[model samples]
Target: WNIENIIDNATLKYSVNFVEDVVNLDVSPGASGIGCTEMVISNLGTITIDVDVEVSGDNITISPGAVSVTLAPEGNITTPICALALTRSEARAHPVSVLALGRETNTHLNQVQVTSNFTAIVDPYARLSIQAPMPAKHCIGSTFWTNFTGVNNGNANDSVVFEVSNIQELEDAGFTFTLPILQYQLEPALLDPLKQNSFQNLVIKVDSENVTEGYYNMIVTIATTMDGESFSAATTYQIWMANCQEQDANIEDDSLPSISLIPTLIAIGIIAMRRRY
Candidate 1:
């Protein structure tokens, strides 16, 4: 036999194609707490494939990391990916890597990397309280002053607005008052969590010309809006107003009898002392 024929007969050649090398994955950014992003994996191979997924990152995680997928020649599946940001302070871009492996060969066929930017948001909560004791009495045409303290109990920064309601209702019941500031801003900037701000010297004036002497109930509301959501706290105060002219007359009437009896009592004591001597 010829040497060239023997060599040609002994040699054999074949080709193998791996679909993982050319596969493409789609990923997007995720929102913290609110929701997650969806990532799609497509299989473009000649044979059915079972893909196993794994995620590597501190700020991101994959649901059902390992999946049993039977691709009919060419198929696709979508998976949910979530971001692990829990606080408002965790506002940053996070790097996440996803790897898909072939179960039979245990080979890493494809890797997809993404920079997920998550929104840092928390529930908004606040508490409102009167910083000073409510004035028991207010004179007509005089101003009543007090302080209100607001505390932010949530993790986010917020701004507070003040509202005074039931004023007209109180006026209907013979108690009239005026609030100089209908809507007062607590602070120019956002208030942080567990932080407090005071609204100093809030003036409530009794209407001298329009109000009748009586007691009235008023409601004060403190509200804050964040991310299209609203949080509010409310409190009530009782206001008592005395007519200035009537009050002066009553004082004068009560003092007149006492003033008239003092001289008579003094004379009797002098006479008693003279008799004893």
Candidate 2:
């Protein structure tokens, strides 16, 4: 029983060449990164394969790396095989370079091989965009509303509305607005119907003049709904004779911040400081 006659084997020589301008590897998790070169010999003809491959700067070379073979139509062939392992240190470390594969066989076995190169690139981080409205400041006798909007990166469609106020009708004698100094409401179906998130909250800033210079207070009532729950954000500010005079200052400023009290409808308001000169 000749051992060579009982086996069918083949030899495969493999080498690698890093392509030019294809370096700087950037790999992610669970990703196949640059590592080693492999050689697979299919349909072996009862033979022994001894592969000795050496890699240099961007190049791979095979030595005496051939296989000798004998074939049996139907039998088990056992042969000695050798493998070569290449590491990152074995290759040229350049930002951009190519590896070349070369083969050399001192045997009569047929040579089978292939080559390829990989590309590198930088990965980018993700970010989110948010949209919102600017706050508005208004004066007494000013019929207006303030609008606010905000988008959350964590909760894109979630937001809320809140309000505070202090209205005083007279001074020294102490007084309060006979009527609510300011009222506000949220638009865009506060708490999106589809998303079901909190509605954006708005805080109305009444011109300090909403009340008299004496002692006075103004009320700011804010209303909105979230998660089918009705919530209110309101506050009150003391108003006095100074508040009434503050309105004069607001009128003089001419550049008071204005807002669309009603959606689609724009109104004017004044922002000014009352200085006790």
Candidate 3:
């Protein structure tokens, strides 16, 4: 009997095959700013084969990196793999190797080298501006509202965060004010390229009663997070405070002469009418 030939024939009868030699993974930013790819493994052997899958790369990560499958004769298995960019600034091609090894024979049966190329599609950038009420004036112990506009100069969706700092520095500079809502997070919005969005009627309370009556200047900082990075911008706001008591006094003084002249004019009209009669 030819036992050696039989063994060689059996070894050559069973084999493994990959559907595609090279897989191209598009690591482009998705809804969650992450990228993913799907892969399929097929078995062309007559008997069930146990195969193990793995991926090797720095930026690319595969879910279920180790997959065990008992593929029937001419059966296939599908796997979903996801990858993300560690840093968004640099866009380049990342080559990753997906190797499938036979568990029983401990042999490398199939290899699919994937080239994940990420382009510099869009850069995240933000522009912030604030518009307050005309005259920027408020009385003591009063609340004022301002309008905030955030524009996404780049091609990505983002959220805006507002913060007020340097209160002590402003007070030392003879301008003291208070923000009722110090930290605010704006709702996330998908901004088109070079398009603007408005957050209307944001409130800020000024403590004019405790501070002196004058122009209070302070800095308002705006920050946004895009592609897991923080970018910030700042602007100065000038708020004028008027003493409530002094405003009332001025109103009364301006109207006092008009109130006194009413009586004198009535008397003069009566005297003139009597002389004519």
User: What's the TM for model 3?
Assistant: 0.40
Highest-TM-score candidate: 1
lDDT, residue 261, model 1: 93
Note the residue pairs that clash in candidate 1: none
Which stretches of candidate 2 lie above 4 Å from their native place?
1-109, 115-125, 129-245, 249-277
> On TM-score, who's better, 2 or 3?
3
**Per-residue lDDT of candidate 2, residues 176-246 (tens digit):** 22233332222232124334233333434333333323343344544433343344444444332334446
**Backbone Cα, N, C clashes tallied per candidate:** 0, 40, 0
Better of 1 and 3 by lDDT: 3
Query: Per-residue alpha-carbon lDDT of model 1 for 164-241, expressed as tens digits?
Result: 667668667655466666444443213333323434335565554456787766676667665554667777777777
**Candidate 2 weakest ten by summed lDDT:** 121-130
RMSD of candidate 3 to true structure, Å: 13.0
Question: What lDDT does the true structure give each of the candidates?
Answer: 0.47, 0.31, 0.50
As a TM-score, model 1 comes out at: 0.50
Mind giving the per-residue lDDT tens digits that candidate 3 earns over 126-217?
A: 44444434447777666555544443332334566666656777556444454555344443233223322434234555444455678776
Error of 1 at 4 (Å): 51
Write down the TM-score of every candidate.
0.50, 0.21, 0.40
